[model samples]
Target chain A: MTRWGMVIDVGRCIGCQACTVACKVENLSPVDAWYAPVVEYEVGEYPDARMSYLPTLCNHCTDAPCVTACPSGALRRRDDGIVLADEDRCIGSRACMAACPYGALHLFEEASGEVLGDGSRGRPSLLEPYTAAGRIPGTVSKCTYCAHRIDFGTANGLMPGVDPLATPVCVVTCPAECRIFGDLDDPDSRVSRYTAERGPREVLRPDAQTGATTAYVGLS
Target chain B: MSAPVTAAPLPQNVFMDRWVLGPKTQRVWGLNHAIWFTLMGIGGGVFLVGRAFDVTTELGRVLGLPLVDVVSFVLIAIGGVVLIADLGRPLQAWRAFRNVKASWISWGAWADLVFLTFGGLLMLPDLEIGDSTPFSGLGWESEADGAGSVMLVLASIAAVVVMLYAGAVLARPRSIPYWHSVAVPFQFLASSLAMATATVLVLVVLDGDDVTSGQAVTLAVLSAALAVSMLLHLTTDKEAPGKKESIDRLVRGSSRTTFLFVSLLAGTALPALLALVAAAAGGARNALVVVALPLLVVGGFLLRLDTLKAGIYPPVTMPSVPARRTRG
Candidate 1:
């Protein structure tokens, strides 16, 4: 009954991009591949100009368009509400990419090193363990909410969101402490408590009716 | 004096600059899909029109071969190859047939296979292989009767479905508003029909026949309908935020030139006008048919390309800020 969700506090966010770097390093994401990126924009004129940053990732909607759009059924939602793409099942149709309103999904066109240097160099050594499925080419990938870490943490009797090792890298590494991740279904969980305490936090594109699990707090 | 009556602080704009979560999705489909859909249109169009016109019975033959059968067979075959080529795993395309309920793509794969199978069967009599078709020993010529007509009809049905599949695939994506309309399927269907009709007109004209007035009328009506449908599809009320943005991109943004000029004007308008001319003249001017045919084909292509180019992923907007902040 664990419906994993995110509560991003935009007010606390400094747009440092440390979380973006952490996500890339943790996931061994390809160069220029941003699994979690801080979107910054300037508001108002010079005297009153205020810089705002909104870090974005997969919302992992309850009713996911990517799941329906994927012809191969490669993108599947787990019981805990985490959506994962099976690289083996993927046919590189990019249908899921088209269906994703958030643009979280990305298809790898070439290897990470090949783009920056000679094609002779292979994947980064850090990616060796994760590259078993060869997701670096012709396969669509996105943030999985650090499912591997979550699974490991759960197996070791650790609570995600309560433990540093169990939570997503972006959540743990946010120097501004802007991210809150926990089970939304659990009333006692941090995310649920935050939702109850905070008045009327909103999910992105609520009009989409995707029933997105991720919510934002103090977006101002 | 209450701290000298200082002015109230500026309340922060929570939803500043319409910031939303996630970046815009890049267009997944490219030249491969464009080529595949264009080929499918031509193949499907030819087969459907040939069935309607009874090209097998009438129009006799060019060099002792039924032109419709040969042309449709070749086009369908090439289209099928192109479709398979676009697949990430060509050998595993059979997996698509196992899941008919998945998407238009699955159904489209099945439609192509069935259409090709039945179409090949229907073309058996006119194949002219003469004891070299591997199955010539089975006396395949005798099978070209009631069963042949049934297979042809089935093939035609599958072909029609194939023609609509491209638009159906595009329209299914909830993110792209421009393609999300009831008009998309019909517009694609009409374009395919127009292209096929024009192809037929070209053949009729080249064959020295002024007896293609019926086809010219069909072409004229279909092209005009296509033009109207394209206009309506682009201008219709888009309730979805994503769709509204997509329509804006098409009508007034970067895609405006291609959408207004190539797709609508040269592609749909001129072809419709030319078809009308052919119909009015009782299909006399083969030159008019010749020019109009390519225009319809090119116009239909430009329409598809423009649609793909203009497709905009939904914009990220500011997630609503809480009415009140929590201490946690």
Candidate 2:
């Protein structure tokens, strides 16, 4: 009964992108891939208009369309609610990309552009040495929710939402303390507590019926 | 270490359409999809029509292969090649067969293979080329007759799947409101049949054969159906956020080609009207039927092209920011 989830206080987010940078450093994501990107938009008109920063990442929905649309069996959702794509099994059909509602998926399209050149650093983009499924060109990728960290930390007797090592870097790195992560199944967990006390159950696009683990607060 | 990523701010002006987090047009499938869908539909359509009309056996070949069967097979083969080439990893394209139970594209892949294999074997012993004269086939013709019936049945099933599969693929992404309709698959099937029927009509005309009273009526009905399907597809999803924008995109935006050609002239009206006239004219070889046949096919292609262009990504709802943040 350990369903991993994250909640964001939209009002507190300062759009500093520290978490965005941390994700890149931690995950070694492919070039042009924003596993966690804060999308900035100007909402409302004139006097009522305000700049809004919506931090977007993979929702890791319980009923994920990408997992279903994957013809090559590349995308899979774990029992803990973490969804990740198998780089080796992917056929680069782009079906998962079209299927994803959050646009979480990214394809490392070309080896020449994504790889580090000059032969000194013989690498095809950055590698996630933690997971057996390494990065490759023409395969899709997305936020792993730092599953490697959560796995290591929990196996060694650490709570994910409470432990810096176990929590997602986006939550750990946010300067404004905008994000919270915990086991949603545990009613006493921070994510659960926050939702019960203050957080709105409405995730983005509640219409999609994605059963998205990520929820938000401070919306009209 | 990965490169330090730059922040991408949404263009303020472009948001004029919806103002908040706006709909993004899906950029994944484009001209390649259009080509694949159109050709595949036409191919499948031709196979269905040719079989339904029982032209496979009546039309003869020196090598014992009917032209209709061979043409349909080649068209689908070309479509399959184009689709595979468009994939990011064409080298591992064979891996598409891994998930036939879930993915429509996988269904298409398997369907294409079966259609080609069974359809290839099913291509008939037909008449001499350029004339109605039935040619006696080579020695094994008598032995091939029984198995050909079973092959025909299998290929027909595969052909129907091929015609419907791409639309099913588009419809699976529920976030894309424009494509998330039963109407899309319906429209795809309709236009596919129309295109296939039009192709058959064109072939019949070119072969100096009289336009059959049955075929002319079928063309009129299918042509009208294509138009009606387009209208239903555009009208029914009026309430969805992306759908209005999709309509605009089709009518005036990048997909105007579809509105002007497919919806208005080629695919629908001209063909429908002319087919009716030709049918009324007692299947006469007329200039209008000749002109409308190609246009009918073009409209079908345009529908596929424009529908892809018009696919608007569902706009994400902005969390209601407090009043203090609204100042421009």
Candidate 3:
């Protein structure tokens, strides 16, 4: 009954992409496929102008449209509320990509992780190992909230979000301490407490009505 | 102060079209989808009309197939091939049939399969090709009428599913501003009917046959409904995120010429008007049918293309502010 969720305090996010880079390194995601991206933005007129960051990733919705749209039964929601895609079953229809509202999913092509001779996104990539693993060409890939680490940690008798070993790399790597991940089902959990304090916890594209698990704190 | 305001809208994504605050058109689906959808619509539409009229005019002894059967089978076959080709993984397309309970594409795969299999069976009596024909002896002219009748019904049912799938798949994406409407399915359904009628009329004429006044009138009506559906889809909640921008893409953006001139004015409206006049004026009906049917069919193609082009994703950020500004 642990409904895993994440709370992002955008008020504290300083546009630093440390979490983005950390997630890339940990997930071994294609270099262009951002599991979590800190979108740098400028707002207001010159007098009130300011630079801000809107860090975005898969919301892992309870009623995920991508899961419903996936023709091959590739995408599924775990009992813990984590949405995942079984790359093997995926037909590469891109229906999940077309259906995702938060722009969290990406289609994997072998060339996406290509290394150039100029040593830019080249040889030293963590991708070489991942490509040999679950990275199936022509299938879809997305954030799992570090499900591997979660399962690994929990199996080893550790708590996620509380223990560094179990937490999503992006949440743990955020220098601004803007991200908190924990079970929303438990009122005592850090993620639940943060929401109670924040009160009117909001999700991006609320009109989508996908029951988004990732809650945000700032923007205006 | 009242409601949260986003940073002034970001300009369109120019650097390889990454991200933008403005509506971003989905480029993943384009010409392939347009052709595939057009063929699906025509196949379904034409099959419906052919079955309704029972036009059994034989083409040749090669397949011994009639005009309508050949048209529907060829188009649907080509569409299925195109759909498979369009996939990021073409060989694994069989997995598309597994999730029909949830996915439209799954339903489409099943529908397309049922349509082809049963429809192929329905068209079976046509094979006077050689001794290789298993259904060679069976014919509507013979006592196997009941069995043939069952195949006809199944094929017709599958045809309807194929037509509906075309729109339903596109409409499933709620994030898309233009394609999310209920009107899309109607537009596709109506367009399919109109295209089918036009195709039938053209084929009937080319074969030197005359359609009754009633069939001509139906064509007029179906084309008019197509026009209305197109208009309804075009006019939606313009205030919603990416909604107005989607409209701009049609009215003033790069798709302007195709939207206004090709689809709306000539392809849709003009065809409807021509069909009406042709139906009303009696003798000149053939000439007008010749002019209008092709236009209606072409317009149907553009409708699929333009609507596909019109889909725009709203910016994901909600622009919520903390109770007090912290950083700035």
Q: Deviation in angstroms for A57 in model 3?
A: 0.5
Name the top lDDT candidate: 3
How high is the DockQ of candidate 2?
A: 0.42
Give the C-alpha miss distance for residue B328 in model 2, angstroms. Answer: 34
| Per-residue lDDT over B1-328 for candidate 2, one digit per residue giving the tens place of the 0 to 100 score | 9999998987554223322366788887899999999899989989898767656445443454666777788899899999989887888899898887689888989999999987765443443456542534532243246776677778899999999999999898787888888878887898888778767767676666667777788888988887777777777857667788998888767667666666557667788888888888873545557777678777877888888888887666644423122100
RMSD of each: 7.8, 7.2, 6.2
Off by over 4 Å in 2: A111-133, B1-20, B60-62, B124-146, B283-286, B319-328
- Candidate 3 stretches greater than 4 Å from native: A111-130, B1-22, B57-62, B131-134, B137-144, B320-328
How do the predictions measure up, each by TM-score? 0.85, 0.87, 0.91
Assess the local accuracy of residue A60 in candidate 3 as a C-alpha lDDT between 0 and 100: 95
Assess the local accuracy of residue B91 in candidate 3 as a C-alpha lDDT between 0 and 100.
Answer: 94
Residue B250 miss distance in model 3 (angstroms): 0.7
**Is 2 or 3 the stronger prediction by lDDT?**
3
lDDT of 3 by residue, A119-138 (tens): 45555354566668668777
lDDT of each: 0.74, 0.78, 0.81
User: Candidate 1: where is the Cα deviation over 4 Å?
Assistant: A111-113, A117-133, B1-25, B57-66, B83-99, B131-146, B238-254, B283-285, B318-328
Rank candidates by DockQ, best first. 3, 2, 1
* Chain A superposition TM-score per model: 0.90, 0.89, 0.92
